[model samples]
Target: MGSTSKMKVLESLGPLLVACLGILGCTQAVTLEVKERNSTCIKAELSALLFITYTTFNSTSNVSTSLPDSTSVDAASSSCGAAGRPPWLVAVFGSGHALGLSFATNGSFYSVTNLTLQYNLSDTSLFPQSNGSGVVTVVSSSVGIWAPINTTYRCASPTTIRAGGAAVTFSAMRLEAYMPGNDLSPAESVCTADQTTTTAPPTTTTTAAPAPTPPGTPETGVFSVTNSSGTVCLLAKMGLQLNVSYVSQSQNKTVQELVNVNPNLTVTSGSCGGTTASLVLTQQTTTLNFTFSMNSTTSKYHLSGINLLANWSDMTAPFSASNTSLDYLRSTLGRSYMCNTEQTLLVVPAFSLNTFRLQVQPFGVTASQFAAAEECQLDQDQMLIPIIVGAALAGLVLIILIAYLIGRKRSHAGYQTI
Candidate 1:
């Protein structure tokens, strides 16, 4: 309690207090409302983290920030119009970012036609090649929301919007256009990522003993195929596993075998063409050939085909499969498709493959790097299940506590004096 000790303690606590305040100020909910002719037309509330990545001096740098962080939005800059101009709303933020949403209405229904985000890269440290600003068309000519006029749209999960090198991700968002009142109502149509699919618990069944463990840990690495100019045209990072079913000569029954495509497999041959790219992985007597194709119209690419050939000592002959007409992995240019859960693909009836922690970008990559990623449905489902379960468990606990209190009160009703 001495004066000197008190001063030292205060000094030590000052930094911690500042750090706590900084963390608290990092994120805040931003609400944008548009009014026309004294009637609120659009209302949106978003509370999410935003990240930016750009190239500077041939190297890519990333900046992470949350929306409405220390920046204010002017009410005068947010406007709505609908007369002959196909109902649109634009909100400008003090950070030199603008969000625009265009709406289209038929006689019965209204839909969002386009969503755009204009960002300014004025900070030289964050964006080295800082020009004035740039525009990223998030969704163009796509029906983002289609509901009856006055319903709200809600998406609780993270949604990624990508365009070329720039991308924006939004989470915990709620929006309403042509609102019935000034406030946002319950959402009528939910985003697919927010929907939950209830799967029945698995049933018990008698089974044989588990098979032996596969060769080694699932190998994970990046595989790329470069073009004639030595530019990487296809890049994929994944852990691969091959499953083969063959007749066991000793047992005279079909037996399942698992093989891990480890990092020891070398790239024996590969080629990148104008419309297609191929990579071949070879190890001992096993070979895997991956073929990818691009769709110019959509500016997207996919793993269109695959071929597998393997020679096992236990099998009578080499197993060969050439699945040319297939569409397994797909993503847009400058973006990758990521799936952390294991994904199974059947090349043939008896032969199948699995991919884990897979992320692939087929084209428009810079500095051998991966751009933004579109998570696979399985990954989204995995994320959603935990939230749903947690909510359910919390509700059950609340119900049990309420029931216990009611039961206790009822039991004490017969007691005269306590």
Candidate 2:
């Protein structure tokens, strides 16, 4: 009897021990290899909760105010005049829970402003930038670095910022991406956004044709991407092909979809940052469908939602496949042929991956038409609310039915045959 009891105890504890080991193995930091070569771009997968600390230059108070983790205030209301309107400095961090922040900016600026971020979770401070004293003058179509702090961003002090008075010295803004739990909190990589002047292309009006390129017409093409190491990360020889289709609705003045889908993507002996491993989509497929809504008035193709299906391949510790739901906001011009280059951050449950650029060339014709505006609009709540309410009502009904049945059983027992 004693031996049997001991055997049962060990069996029950075996799975628990394995699970604990798995948790420990998975907590180590993950890095993404960022690559930008001409027009093609790719990066290692990332998944984690993201946080941000925004420091806005309060021109009215003549002091900079630090907003911890997605907090926002009005910039135009500040006494900084036009300088306080656009191009606010923002820091983004990722750790895993879901929250929402506004990335919509006024027409004059490229960056987002007037943010009142809200979240419901166990909040913790991940970034701590010391208070610094200084005033920086900014203007339209220029990049200025906020000043007066330690180079390592650890200690705070007064800062002096200056730029060219005659010609433009800086053309873009950059934000860094770093690994979690670093002692120095050093930035491993940087993402840059440039300011550019665009000329609107002339619009051509076409009368309705009897059967204008039937929508949802399936077209197939194969393209391959090779890394600097001479290893083929994506090869048509390795059974890779993209299937695309488009649908046009005339009355609604919208073009619904253009799906560029690839399946069974297998990577052999590929290096992601420092690790060389094989990558396989657990679902064995990846679909990037562009749902477009056209505005006839502006002659623009606004993106509605990007349907992405990404899962991890089978790998060992420090490398696991995480389910990902990517968010992207973009728009394009309405033209026969289009070529739009855009980048977005892919957020997963474990880490936030680096930026990657994607080019869409439809119908075997390559031309410039699509353009991307950095924005995020998610419908997570709209999809979740109905299910939550239904589940609560069903559970309440179940409890009442169970109580009624139990009461009847007790009443019958009370008048049992005596």
True-structure RMSD, every candidate? 29.4, 27.1
lDDT of each: 0.64, 0.26
Worst 10 residues of 2 by lDDT: 162-171
Give the lDDT of residue 416 in candidate 1: 94
Per-residue alpha-carbon lDDT of candidate 1 for residues 226-253, written as tens digits (9 for 90 to 100): 6546677677898888888875544445
* TM, every model: 0.45, 0.18
Q: Write the per-residue lDDT of candidate 2 for residues 122-183, one digit (tens) a residue.
A: 22232133132232221111111211111111111111111111111111112211112222
Tell me how many residue pairs clash in candidate 1: 0
